[model samples]
Target: MSKQSIVLEPVRCPDCNQTHIVKHGKSAEGKQRYRCRNSECSRHNFILNYSYRAYLPEVQQQISDMAINGSGIRDTARVLKISQTTVMETLKKKTLH
Candidate 1:
C-alpha cells in the first residue's frame, strides 16, 4: 500500500476574507510573510510564522466551530490554549463568510 500526502490548507487573515494573499517577504526569524489585498483591512502585512500559537490547521478549524457552537471567545480561547484576541479575530472574520 502506498501512502498519500495530505495537503494542509493555508489560512487567511480574520480581518479581510480575501484569499488573494501573497508573500511579501520573510521575518527576522525566517517566518513566512503574507500581504492582504482587501483594501478595507488595516492589516495589510502579517507574519504567518508564530512561534507557538496559530501553527496548527486543526486549531483554526476548532476556532471556527467553537464560534458556531455559541462558545464565548474567552471560553474558547481558554479551552483551545489560544489567545482571546485570536478567537475574537477569527470569529469576526468568519462572520464575513
Candidate 2:
C-alpha cells in the first residue's frame, strides 16, 4: 500500500474575507482560533467551531423574541434546548450592544 498525502487548505478571515490568516491560539475548549492579518479588519480573531447554539444567528433572534414575548429565562432555555446560563448570557450580550 502506498502512503497518501493529506493536503490542508489555508483558512480565510471572516471579517475581511481575506485569505491572509495565522493561527492565534487554542480556545479553552482546545478549538483552534485564527487571527486576521489585515490591519484594517475589525475582527482580530475568531474560532471556526462555535460549539454553542447561542452563537447561532437564529438562536440569537429567538432569544430577543422570547424576551420581548415575556418568556422567562428558563422557558427560553428549555424551548431552545440550551442552558439557562446560555440564555441569560445571550440576552446580556444583546443588551450591551
Clashing pairs in 1: none
Best by TM-score: 2
lDDT of model 2 at residue 68? Answer: 88
Instruction: Supply every candidate's count of residue pairs whose N, Cα or C atoms clash at under 3 angstroms.
Output: 0, 0
What value of lDDT does candidate 1 attain over all alpha carbons? Answer: 0.77
Q: What are the per-residue Cα lDDT tens digits for candidate 1 across 1-97? A: 9999999786687567678788898877888888998888877887765776654556878988877788988899899998888888777766534
For lDDT, the strongest prediction is 2
TM-score, candidate number 2: 0.63
lDDT of 2 by residue, 1-97 (tens): 9999999977887668898899999988898988998999977888877887576667878999999889999999999998999888878877633
lDDT of each: 0.77, 0.84
